[model samples]
Target: MPKNIYFIALCLLCIWGCRESASKAGANKKDSINKVVQDAAHEIAGNFSDQRSLRFSANRLDSFFTRYDSLRTFQKDLTTFYTERNYAFAWYSDSGLTEQASHLYVRLENLPEEGLNLVLPYKHTLDSLINAANTQTLEQKSETELLLTSLYFFFAQRVWAGLEESATQKIDWLMPRKKLSYSALLDSVLKQGNTANVKEPVYRQYNLLKEYLKKYKAIPASSTTISLPGNKPIRPGDTSPEIVKLRKKLFLLGDLTNAGDTSSDTYDSTLLTAVKRFQRRHGLSEDGIAGAGLIRELNIPVPQLIEKIMVNMERNRWLPTDVRGRYLAVNIPEFVLHAYYDDSLLWNMNVVVGKDVNKTVIFAGSISQVVFSPYWNVPASILKKEILPGIQKNPNYLEKNHMEWNGPDVRQKPGPWNSLGQVKFLFPNSHSIYLHDTPSKSLFQESKRAFSHGCIRVANPKFLAQYILRDDAAWTTDRINKAMASGKEQYVAVKDPIPVYITYFTAWVDRQGDLNFREDIYKRDAQLSSLLMKR
Candidate 1:
């Protein structure tokens, strides 16, 4: 052959060789996928048929459900799921179990990272069934099939939909719990496999936090606290050996895009910026100080943070599916009130929630009236605990506090000196908890702001009032201010009731997709965390 002809022949040979190798790789990949199903069927050796099929009907499901009573509540739903397919085999085939079943098995086994404590479906029997060590009779196959379906329901209920309403109520989480159709979900998952929205019902925050959970899990737990000698704050410009450690810590947390120069031990502006980012994310003062509080926050194990993330994910499950209309959401732990219109967040502001003694109840209500120059009705407990003492000290306590007796109960006159400030947004509930302006505006500046008697004290009361009254042509800013200044009690009913949801969440992802960890000011996280880690 000529030189050009020889070169052409060599190229063709090389191309053919590459094609042959690619074909082999493709076959290997397919085999591996099928192997997952094959291995599972092999484990659960049975008097199996050549064609994979279900041995039981919907009527037989009840008998099998007796073995997994926890799944009794979902028996009807599970039956519908299996019945949809005329009770055909879902997991297995003549060759082996289907790949979707294999996917579900892996997903169920990894529920721990999702923070589930329940025993898995077919815990011991699964191993023997998959490996063919234990022969599965027709009846046994039917039982195992129903059991796996029960576990799927369990996963959806516990991980995605959350615990029963009674359980959530026991924890005092009273927001309208999101309702999910597990029957529909089961049907979708079985038909579509991994493409189904298994994690769809969950809040976006759950998925966002899961990313951080994986990253945090990769980080080693810090047993020792990042202590500073004399327990002093590490102010900006201070040179401490801890600066290097802090840089790496912040970097791991994604506060610092780059760790910057760690060679120099000085607390430079670069690291200070990172420290401020960390502080801001955690709802702390951005004072550029690595103080004892910051050190304590830093020392919290990544695993603990991951648990917090998971705990909050479960809480999100309790939230409603749609919050599109105008409403107010106050996160007690974050000490912030988020205002939404048409499901879009308009803005958020600092709020003073109830202390541990008088926790701000987590529930939903409607803001029906904006009470301008409203009287502060003293609760019986406060009267005995705080007011009775005041009157005991001063004979003119009622006059001094601008309070007057209204029947048996006393109320403070609305003014700048009033506890309820210029205005109060009323959301009629048994708890009598509502959002109101406070005379003490300075408290809003504090990083930790939980000093209320079961109600929320909004920092930007005027702004909140403006937002609430924007739709009503009758209430202009000037007229609203006049009403507030009149110091005479007045009530204006809202034509459109705005829903108010007071929630308690210690951890949530922010608008910027950054994870935010707020201090559990009401000390609720400990109890909830204990409940979650019960396994």
Candidate 2:
């Protein structure tokens, strides 16, 4: 046998004996499993005289299968994975453990700091294993290598891929969760051949959130929550002690540049400017008034904001990486529709999303059609909940609303009052939700705009229509206006499919590189916050 291989066999034999002693010493359950692993390693070592034997020694790992039941849903996958790889040390070289192994171990240790819920075991031991003195001998080197690989899988599953699909569905997040191939990711890590480039492959937003996470974490935690005493908006000439408190709060939150001046209790021009900046960063009215809306945002503590940032970071992990093509994303909480072409924001406008009771689903679809002057085929739920009640109050509800029964289903005629307004962007989805124009434009002016039944209501339909049909040569400004003016329902098929995501993120970074937080209208943040608190 090769000298190092022989030495490894002797170490495994010792490990087997030590596990037996530990079992006798009442380390019962896990020590017995360790004994099985040690035995399998030794049993396979006899045939390890050549690389050929090592390459074909898959059967030896079967006895230790029960040892990994803690891996839960990943157990069977781990089995087939190890068997296919012939139980070889995945992150090791013949001489010693590879550098990528250490990189992975450190990342696992830092996972919690990156907003992960669970804490990885044996971080200190893993750090000790990389110490200079521990590597003096090759004893137990392969075992350490395998242990690190297993830990890497555990960390990647929890932190990068997020909780299972059912768990995410419970939180009402319907966006497709991203999946990662551990083997492929490790292969790329190994291919890099250096520690400098080793990183967890996640969505682009993950990196952006990390930068903001650092910024938020730098703010010191407040000792006590302070409330601004006001039932109304503070005007420019208003004088109160609350103005001084508001100034300090905005300064702490980075809305004010100077923290040195605290001499005045009046809402001066400088204070008004800072308040306006703060209001703009938030999705509130930027009218330079410290109203209840602005004050509520101001009083949110740094720690709560940090938790919000971390929770959104977890959501970022579930985002698709390839957002390069032309796409329209509607952030439900922010009430904004962003048009992006290859990661660059083409334009953005206000939008009204579903209310608390009728939440717009968080999912993706391909927008393949745009309908102009569309009829509103009211959903059955709406018909039962709204139309029936309205009919009970007034028999002329159908005539007043210009709705007629067509083959037992009620639909409104295409016109100014048609619930879908002048245009509707169709993206085939099971949820039956799409973006459409609405006659109620006043709702868009509200800071909190969750008024629709389910579909999104775009504030600027003409702007969106023009931007969407820009590529089609046949559709010109005059033609689009003429088509919209024809007072007829028209369906225009989009040449290229644009991916649209109806997302729910209460906290997100805007195009101006500013961190913005909105009201948790659907109350999803608490559910995610609970999930993230699970150790």
lDDT of 1 by residue, 80-109 (tens): 776665677666565556555667777777
Q: Per-prediction TM-score, please?
A: 0.83, 0.82
lDDT of 2 by residue, 154-222 (tens): 776776787778888887788887768876665566656554496766777776777777777777787
Find the candidate with the highest TM-score and give its number: 1
What does the lDDT come to for candidate 2? 0.75
lDDT of 1: 0.78
TM-score of 1: 0.83
Name the TM-score of candidate 2. Answer: 0.82
Clashing pairs in 1: 42-132, 43-129, 43-130, 43-131, 43-132, 44-129, 44-130, 44-132, 45-132, 324-343
